[model samples]
Target: MNRSGKAVIVLLILLAAASISLSGVIYYNLEKEKSQTNNLSVEISDIESEKARLEEKIDEQKTELSKVYARLEQNEKKFKKLTFSIDEEKRKSQEVVSESASLRKDLADTKTAKVDLERKITQNQEELDSFKLEIAQLKKVKDVLQAKLKELTGDFDVELGKIVIGPEDASSKSSPRIDATKKKSAASNLEGKILVVNKEYDFAVINLGARDGVSVGDMLSIYHKGNYVGDIVIERVDEMMSSANFLSSNTKEKVKEGDKVVYRSS
Candidate 1:
């Protein structure tokens, strides 16, 4: 062999070795880049899952807040109702107090009126007692006057014939004759004395009866101490007793027991 041919063979061998080393280095770098890309994609997916969970918790908190607001509104309405009830009770209490005051005033006025009525009753009773005392005093004075008049008059006891009747006659002869006739008529009339007086019936029982010329329908005059008391009409007559009814001219004077009953001149 020649020297120049040997140098060309060595140069071709060196170029082939350099090309193989460059190809191995490029394949190793490409595999390492692919593995890094896969790891990055997995990390991004995990972050998205965590965000969805956080959003769900926020929605639940909002729903709870709405419930709390609703309860607060209901409590406010209850407080308003309680306040109105308290005001109504206070108004009713005021009305009851006013009515009690009015009733007490009326009761006090009624008590005052009752006291005045009692005072009037006492005054009227005292006046009635004073009037009764005055009447008793007047009765005593009248009795004294009646006794004095009786003492001044003379005794009137006499026979029936001696008593004058209506008018006197001028001549003594005519006077005797008239006197005789009057005596006969007077004797025929009823004459008696009161034995008992029945004030309730306004009647009297006489001592004279049919035996003394006394008969029913006979008129008699009752007298007390020569003063005319009343007139009587005979109702019944027996042998010694007669009953007569009194006819009053004055109501104040009453015929009593032991009064004289004389014949009335017709």
Candidate 2:
């Protein structure tokens, strides 16, 4: 072959080798670039996931904040209600204090009224005692007047066929004695003197009986020395004497030897 043709062939071989080398280098560079692109895509996905999580946490915080605000509003309303209740309680306490003071005044008034009633009762008791004393004095005066009238007009002894001597000496008189010599007759005065008394047997004998209009169940008021003594009821009787039992004992001294006796009226 010719020399120029050999040189051309050699040049072509060199160019082909250069082309293959360049293509291998370019392929290696392209593979490395592809690997970097894949890594970048993975990093982008991780970043997106982190951003979504952060947004969810923000929403949760917002929800918690709303709940807190609601609770705060409820606490404020409760505080206001408590203040109103305190004011109402204070007003009721004032009313209760006023009522208590009024009740205390009423109690004091009642105590005063009770003391006044006791004083009035004591005064009334004193008046009753005075009346009893006055009655006793009046009875004594009446007895004295009657005795004076009997002395002035001796008809009481002559008409009745009895004497007006003292009770101690009247028994010795012949007419007053219950003997066979005396005559039984209806008595006008219906009066008597105690002749005998049996305190152990609770009985007494008077100088008046059937003839003196004395009957069973007749009450007699007895006196000793012008002092009121007691009462007695006639239980038995004879022609000139009546037997009686004491119905009541009033004086400290029991019925005695010369006690004056008179018929009692209701």
Candidate 3:
């Protein structure tokens, strides 16, 4: 009875040890699997966060590209404006150059005209010397005649407002007498249209008179359109009108109605 009880007790102890060892191994394996599962969950969370960050970065880049595009469009508009300004300035420069060329031609023509006028003036001076010499001879003859008249009449007789000698009677002097070319006057540079013209009487009527500072004896230059026609001497002046006699004329033109009249002198 004792031996059988001892053997049964030993077998029960052995079975209990094996069962505990098996339970310990299963617990360890389960714990390791649980730790691996937790690590996987954390990795998934990290991946999701990374994806969100990447999406945000993409949106930021898109916003930046839109800004760049807007700036490019504005720059293009500025470039167009600059190009237009340059073209406009170039056109204006060309016009100015053309005007400069025209002005140079006009200056050359004016110089040529001045040379011709100077030549004509020299010709007139030669004729003036001849006339002055003739006048000197006439003065000598008049002096001899005056001496004979004084001897016959006992005294030299003279009349009022009449003189035998003129104010410019220095014949013995070598200096020449010169008539000056009348200069243009600012106050007398008035212009008016002719109201009437008379070829037979050689007279014309003008609109400007005393009220416009025009008086009798005032010389006026006449022009048909812009071309020179003649000159006129004022004979009568009314309140707002005047009558002028033709004093001179161009060989090819005559004073006519609607012609412009201004102050003139030779």
Candidate 4:
């Protein structure tokens, strides 16, 4: 309780006050740190929940991706099969095209052969018709010759007793006798015009016939403007028309329609 004791007491009172203030500050700082630690813990918990949700969504996406990959593999297999089928179709189409071309060529060849065969048949038919016509004409000539032979035999029977055999008479009997028709045709002065001239067939149709003193095998001269063009031998005769064949040796020019034909003896 003297002066020095009073000073130490005052210093102890200040120290005590400072210690009280520092304790209060430390308590306030520890409470603030505790509040901050609780807030951080709550934030960490929320982060963990969000991370779990994201992981689950990622699993779903992986499953969907696997399904997509499976579908893509199936489509690739189908495309490969379709490509092989398309190649086969193209090859078959080419083969069909080649076969069709070959068939068309064969058909064309067959058509050509058929045309040639038809032409040959037509030619043969024309020749056969000509032969039939010649046979008919020969039959008529035979009838006429048979009738003349009958008449001559009847005449020979009537003159057989009066006939005498002599050397000069024997020669005369052996000589060939001329038909009356030939003699008449040779002396005939019949004149007529040609109606048709077929140069390809080498024949002519004349206006003269049997009625005009024209007979079969009678030679006639064809004249154009008083000049001899050719000669024709009568082959077939009608009442007003006659068909004659051209004499190749006597043809000086091509005969034409309306040319004059005069009978002449050969």
* Candidates' C-alpha lDDT: 0.53, 0.56, 0.56, 0.59
**lDDT digits (tens) for residues 1-266 of candidate 2:** 79866655555555445545544544553454345445645554554555455455546555554654555455555545645665667665666656545545554554555555455545545554554444444343334334434443453334333222233432332322354323222343355667666544567777676646777887888888887788888899753467788875443247885688887756
Residue-wise C-alpha lDDT for candidate 4, range 171-224, written one tens digit per residue: 233222347677565547778887766554667777776546677898888889
TM-score of every candidate:
0.30, 0.32, 0.30, 0.32
Better of 1 and 3 by lDDT: 3
Clash counts for the predictions, in order: 0, 0, 0, 0
Candidate 1: which stretches are off by over 4 Å? 1-186, 189-191, 249-253
lDDT winner, 3 or 4 = 4
Residue 55 error, candidate 2, Å: 1.0
Give RMSD to native, each candidate. Answer: 78.7, 71.3, 63.5, 71.3
Candidate 3 lDDT at 223 equals 81
Q: What would the per-residue lDDT of candidate 3 be over residues 60-97, giving only the tens digit for each residue? A: 55565565555555555655664566567866566665
| Candidate 3 colliding pairs, count | 0
Clashing pairs in 2: none
What is the clash tally of candidate 2?
Answer: 0
Candidate 1: clashing pairs of residues: none
